[model samples]
Target: MGGTVTLRRALLATTAATVLAFLPNTAQAAVSYPDPQPITGQQIIHDPTVVRLKSGGYVAYSTGGVIGARLSKDLKHWDDAGNAFAEPPSWWYEYNDTGDPWAPDISYRDGTYWLYYAVSSWGTNHSAIGVATSPSGRPGTWTDHGKVFTSEKTDTWNAIDPAIIKTDGRLWMTFGSYWTGIRMVQLDRTTGKAVQGATVHHLATRPDAPYAVEGPYIVKHGRYYYLFASYDQCCAGVNSTYKIRVGRSTSVTGPYVDSTGKPLLEGGGDLLLEGHGRYIGTGGESVFRAKGHDWLAYHYYDADDEGTPKLGLNQLHWKENGWPIAL
Candidate 1:
């Protein structure tokens, strides 16, 4: 009787362990991500922010070459349209010696196209976010508007990867990098620069040191404001660990939390999309609306094509629970 009881107990323990092995964890669970939509032509880009133009078609602005530009008629086959500026703005040299700009955000507002971009040396917190205006959302039409915001080495937040949104009739820009994660500041409606004496608001950060979250792009869907950000190391080609994560809050300035009710500041973000198969290091994401649907635009390191960072686009779907799923 004792031997039979021991055997039964051991069998139950083994079955329990097997079931536990298949359970999901926050960071390492096996979640299959869909591949990016097929794209062709000049696909190489980094930190892409796409916007549908008022005139026609689509344009993408990204890091490198005085805010590199790519134009597409159908959002499928992209063509390199050269740098947005003929030369780097004179003031951009104050932060970076080369005047090399990075991670531009472009949007059309009130009959004018606004361009916000960053200038900073690699691995430094001394940075500046600059704004420009374009009569037409074309490569060479942008007129530099000088620095909209800046951050020094003494600051906890690194000012880069600028993303803009308007809510409650006020303009706000969310920007940050590795130092303290994502942050936000109110902008002047007319000038499009950070308001004088504006209170800088903390948005998201990892609990651990060297907090890796950055590239914050917020979109209001239904009743919740969804904050999309890239997490982990980037620009290392195939070895990069970059992936996209998200959290949502009712307020524009959030105590944003993941689907599990964990705060983003506490390293709580639901994994929206990540590297899988040949598309390695998928990150640097932004959202845009076109054809009556929301679309996600980002860049991914293509392992099959020498790990070149290229454009990745996917349709975003909202679940019944109001969470976003990238299809």
Candidate 2:
């Protein structure tokens, strides 16, 4: 999510291949992207999830106290709607000094809107995932449902960056940041928490040092389910190397492979979008279908604006081979 990143961490070393993303001689060189749409008013957001409300407006939830909110009638322009919580949720203080939440996931089912969020200390495995439900999906009406899942200091996986997908009548949440990459678990449809006995499934990881993959978002197209994630460092203004990458599988739960036959479990992926011109470290995304198009909504550091975080939207298209490409 958008926060102050020290210069040292923002300049972390990139893997050999990711280094090629910026060099002209490398085969893995990035695919050029058209300039991202310039968002106006109430533009600061991190790890944003945009959802269209039934009442006919758009709501965007992001990282911070009460799960920071922004509302828009047209999605092109936005206005700050204050935090989703009127007061702090005491439970979140167990993991972080502030009862602030981060990386919220927004979804609606059975006439109720569900907002899943994370609480954690920066760069630590200690974290908890929580949920709140709203009757109208508007700010100030959500009720905190408390922790859905959590990770401790000893756990290999960090529990943050939550995203959910309902497939085959089941709701599954995908989360994690630094520790063991991205992991998923099934949630009880009735409670929106982890199913009593369901196992946590590992989805993606980088074996090399400074693994750096996070922000897992899954979306299905045609007959395949695709996993989207951020690669490398983020929150570093224009210095952040974060980019969106993708892999696919016919089954949502197992064995996601990239375009070149590399498994995501071992860091395989096909590039979707990367830095271009004023847009740098373009990642931390959410995907949703709108008006017959699949949209990849993410945040980017605007190089021209003192490297501040801003909302970025791009139309995602699928190829004949079924791979997702961001335009």
Candidate 3:
């Protein structure tokens, strides 16, 4: 996610009074809207994944500092918990000398919390997927599990945004951003590592789109695997044109399709969200269902002030056709 500051036109004196006068009536009306809450601690918090901890509190992890953690009770207000993985693993420094921590996906299974992160330079094919572990999803107590997958510098496809899904007693990882498109590989459950003989399968791509497609996240609901991704350039301030798009398939390794029956593998995706209001370039989505409602956490460039990218959270509602619409 990026950092941004949005400046709304200050309410005029008359408008303020009018709004206040109708506030009580509006509050009594049927629909209730969630107030926008800003999360602190880091300037940019991208690719955020929020999970309900065993203790009932919430832990949110995102890119930057190999992943930063924040805690919340009500899910609206957040308190920074600091960087989860501050020190780069020895192998990471040995290979790249510097760590460009991108997207991180955290999950709990088999008595441990697994953190899958991407290490690579922006817009480059030189990247690798790695795993880390923590007894609990807290800060300052993670152990790196070395590299899981790597892309050759010669390959066009860059591997990043590692999201893991466990199904039918097997673990599978979906990854890839720039260069080629989204790819997936099976992972060893015990080690949280890629299986030796597993080959990366091309899951989705949009090479012909205006820009490269990336930031692949998957959420399985009902009988379908929902594949969500950001399309176009991100982090370009006001000029950025990033937006979230999605498709779904019955099978994990799919020929996913949009509502209009366009296949994702064939460069088809239904638009989930785009820029609006003072927000520009909204993408890099991570979805969570909490309090009986779906919420979308993503980053976007704030355009009101000098454009800065920042994390954004909004409620997600599903249309009758099974597609998500962010409010």
lDDT scores in order: 0.89, 0.84, 0.75
Expressed as tens digits, the lDDT of each residue in 1-327 for candidate 1 is 979986875575445434433443342235457688778899999999999998899999999888899999999899999999999878888888999998999988899999999999999999999999998889999998899999998999988999999998999999999898999999999999999998889889998878999999999999899999999989999999999999999999999999789999899998988999999998999999998989999999999998999999987867646777766
Least accurate 10 contiguous residues by lDDT in model 2: 8-17
What is the per-residue lDDT of model 2 for residues 21-107, given as tens digits with 9 covering 90 to 100?
A: 344321344434645554678988888998988998889999855788999887679999998999878998998887878889999
Clashes of each: 0, 0, 7
What's the best-to-worst order under lDDT? 1, 2, 3
Give the candidate number with the greatest lDDT: 1
What is the C-alpha lDDT profile of model 3 across 6-42, one tens digit per residue?
A: 3231233224334434432212123222222456544
Every model: Cα RMSD to truth: 10.4, 8.3, 8.0
* Of 1 and 3, the candidate ranking higher by lDDT: 1
Say which candidate scores most in TM-score: 1
Question: Which ten contiguous residues of candidate 1 have the minimum total lDDT?
Answer: 20-29
Q: Is candidate 1 or candidate 2 better by TM-score?
A: 1
Q: Give every collision pair in model 3.
A: 1-46, 2-309, 2-310, 3-308, 3-309, 3-310, 4-309
Is 1 or 2 the stronger prediction by lDDT?
A: 1
RMSD of 2: 8.3
